[model samples]
Target chain A: MDKRKDAGSWNRHKIQAVWALLTNSYLIGFAQGRIYKGSLKNLCLPGLSCYSCPGAVGSCPIGAMQAVIGSWNFKFPFYVAGFLLFAGALMGRFVCGYLCPFGLFQDLLHKIPFPKKIKTFPADALLRKLKYVILAVFVVLLPMVVVDILGQGAPYFCKLICPAGTLEGGLPLVLLNESMRSAIGWLYVWKNALLLLTIVASVLIYRPFCKYICPLGAVYSAFNSVAVFRYQLDQEACIGCGACAASCEMQVDLIKHINSPECIRCGACKRACPVGAIHFRQAGKSRQSNTTGL
Target chain B: MKRQLQSSKAGILLALAGLLMAGVGMHRGEMSTVFEKAVKICMECIGIG
Candidate 1:
């Protein structure tokens, strides 16, 4: 097979793995009478899979962070913080590219037939900053300072904003269990509405939430420079055509900075590179042929 | 053979983690207990329930 075809097949496999992780609701039944109390609680998966999801086998780091921040007894979740650091160091925002169920959902939505595509604008530069502000205020500081002091803690972002929680955890349980539906109120209605709006927006736009919001993406992005999986650029390669930048929806100028925070390691830039300059390097291993220069 | 072994190991580890999380999440009285605690906390904070 041609090298390009081989790369495409590998990408397809990765995409399939992502799909399985996202839609593993049936695994909930296997969890019945199986799990125990004392287990590994720290340094979990990078994506925002809800711990409350019946099929979820690991702790949701965001949920864990909220719980720790909300708790009056605990000072802060050093364990979760360390975990995010570890995950970010290992994979960078590849979690956003290959792991996040919500990201997959958005990608699927974008595949729908839409006349006009949501083009990136100069205002997006300012809007992207909103996610970091949210991470600092809502995800980190609010629960720790305000809620904990008041002896109340809630996953504020998940409650008010996260359509992932509604779509992945809320909708499934409600559909399966009638009791949950009866308990639903205005908040549930609001979350469901938000999910609907996000779905519609995702179809029209290219991952608007991942681009603008999502504190997790913000966290992973900060570690892009020093991550284990690093993107290398061959400066020796001739021809500085602007093809890679044009192909990259993330808007990263690959020639200038291969490790830009905006880069999710989606390989689109690599695929667009004509001179085979951009590539993914894992540790000190031999550089393998990837999607670069397709 | 080495690659196959590595793949199997990964599968086993994931399965074990899944079992452990589910078990802790759904022990006879504990599941409802955790949910109640989480909901009560959410209700007081958000003023919903």
Candidate 2:
């Protein structure tokens, strides 16, 4: 392993590590088994953390969108929509690589030595599109179409499908609060089952949730090709070594699809490049940064 | 530089649009609405009911 490549991975991992703590640092809320009621709850984190999580000071954007869209008024989730566009424009799926607690969860699970590490398969590309379906149906259409007597909609994604809510928020709350435990029913049981599936799948595959299920990642991926900061391939300096593609778990064809929506901007290719060909170009910066090879 | 400008154009427009929409949401008191809902006053928001 090249020390330079190792350092880059380390820096990213370090940010992921600190981010996990900072995002869920409302310690007293966890001890008491109560959700944080602070004003910070109004802001949406780029990650898919559960607002119901006792320690979550900020709301998850997906949940926030559903909440607003599902409200009786059925207004557009302007705030949440804005935030997603804002985040997408700035970083694309870089958030998936470095910021999301759920992404961190899956990354850790994938590291737990398994019989096989499945990067992708025949149905991988098709399966990857599932997140967009989930975003369209569970997050958007279902909430709007399926309404109650009062015209309010349910947070369908959170209640029915979100392992983030189940794992981060539901599990901890149920464990600590006796009252919540007593009230646990079929919905809780169903969510826990989904959470269990996600955990098991993570061990066998890499970032399975990000690849297939996370609606937030789906949103960010839309902007990946044109995000303000993105990877660039210098055709002039290229040797076509294929190392970058070989190293990429996402299997992105580095030259043809340098900034494809599927690319998570994980820098795995950048690390794998033996030649000084790949670099990150910021929107307004005169020079591309970190153009040197490992 | 021309290529760079072309690429950055979409992103800059998107950022500005996001800011404008967020401003509208703020003016409409939607942030407070998010707060109220995140507080989880009703069980149905989380599907317990």
Candidate 3:
């Protein structure tokens, strides 16, 4: 009945689901506005679903929030904010692990048969601060402050750096639409090239963007401590083998705190624990006695 | 069997939500002539108008 024995099946199912969601061209087409009025609309999803995707049925909360706050007549977007908070509270970074189409894309790119693996440098404390700075400046304050002053606001992250927007929204549509191809300028080519480079780098690096960047990850991480469906470490059972930390791609020191914000609950640590020292339960689940495993 | 049933129910609920949203988006014009309002809502939601 140990969950670790069946961990392979769980990981496989999660990976398969990710592929299904990402490669569903019909869904992509719907999001891109091809099936609709040929205008970009918002989806109410918590993650960054590109409004430009033809198959997207709801608005991306991140994009929607930016558009609302950047508007000349500023009014609070209660629906979008409420939806994001609700989703974040319920699932935490489980959304990052399983639901995000963009995250799925990054995972696939990381699966390429590369000779080397990029390990995290935990000693480099400055590198860890980058995502928080990005979240505070680019994701939150900049959009509200700079865009309001300029009288025109853009999805700054998407326009400048987000390889996700290029991969999920731009490249596919441009290939399909002839007019779009003609309208493509130097900027479009530059963005596409950046996306291509990231894809190639991901093979060598384990989620470079998620580790060092990704404002959304920064936000979701803050809630990981209290999120429902959290990981619990049986301290007495832990032999301090460090196997969990060794296997962790997210670079979490699970023995210290399995529910650390950096821990994506990817269950790598749970599976890696030789002594079955780790288990997952809902946040409010009664704490059980911690018994050491032989 | 019970676990399988619960998973199936969860899957169904997610699928239904996705379908309902897609349907509503498709008939957006019929639902509301609130393009400007929707844009405004989206702008505030995203912090870029």
Candidate 4:
């Protein structure tokens, strides 16, 4: 489906734009090469904005989780976990759809009017499970288990994998801070390569990182089936037109897998339906006519 | 029908539990811990120290 024809896409982009700005509002910090030191950083943002970013005012949940787990105390990250659970239970990967800065970055990139856009591939299903593995190892296990002699575990995902940190944090900081420039090494080169690869992939495909690498997406996806606010198909109204499937950038089979974990609940399917069969059904509330406010 | 009911209950319960745990974590000063990390530029973590 042409994104221009999908009615829900416009509202989603507006929300994503506003949310990205609100989460990264420390404009002066970017100029000065310093992060926001305000108390607001204590609250975890649902999206994957790197806290190290000069303009970031809130902490990234995934980064905060690794920090809490890898701290000298080595405590389980109850706060971050609780935040994820609350957000996931409330709306599942809707956060990814409407809030994630990296997601928005990819969305904007994928809209660059490339000649060919590969929606899905043969290894898509198998490759989709890679994020779960990364979540288990890089995000959760390595931080909790692998420690230096001093018992401090590094944020392995941030250092080694996350392109957001590279683009948002490392690049700006190094460029702005002369003292930090001398410290650049092989790791910086490595991260830049990954960031470039991600950028190219984003232009050619829709949300490759979200589909294949994001740990936060992995966690939220686990709650998709049980999320209180979710998409539902009205069997009586659906005309087997397959418009929903055609509209989904994530390529979710909106009929057979209405509750699939792969769904980001972007509401493209809802707007694409000729019969208006799709609706956002909040528990105990009546069915919604449109995707507004969702 | 039964499964959706169960999932609804589970989701509600988990939300409640999250509320409780977050409150406890805040009381225990985990919020400050997050603030501490977020405030500083970690050179080694992002590999730009």
Best candidate, DockQ: 4
Q: Comparing candidate 3 with candidate 4, which one achieves the higher lDDT?
A: 4
- The TM-score of candidate 4's chain A against the true chain A comes to 0.96
Off by over 4 Å in 2: A2-6, A286-294, B41-47
Q: lDDT tens string, model 4, A8-43? A: 577788889999999999999888988898889989
lDDT tens digits by residue: candidate 2, A218-278: 9999988778878888888889989888878778899788888878877878878777577
Candidate 1 residue pairs in clash (backbone atoms < 3 Å): A34-B23, A35-B23, A35-B24, A36-B24
lDDT-superior candidate, 1 or 4: 4
* lDDT, model 3: 0.58
Give Cα distance to truth, residue A83, candidate 1, Å.
0.7
Model 1, span A1-294: residue lDDT tens: 246644753574467465546434446433441221223222245687655454554555676667666666554555556567667766778878777877777867876888987767779889989889888877777777776346766678767777776765676666666666678888888887878888898888778888888889998898776666767777787368977788776788888887899887777767666777776665443264454221
Which candidate tops lDDT? 4
TM-score of each: 0.77, 0.94, 0.74, 0.95
Candidate 3 local lDDT, B1-49, one digit each (tens): 3433343344344334545543543343311222232332221221122
Off by over 4 Å in 4: A1-7, A289-293, B1-6
Candidate 3 chain A lDDT trough over 10 residues, lowest sum: A285-294
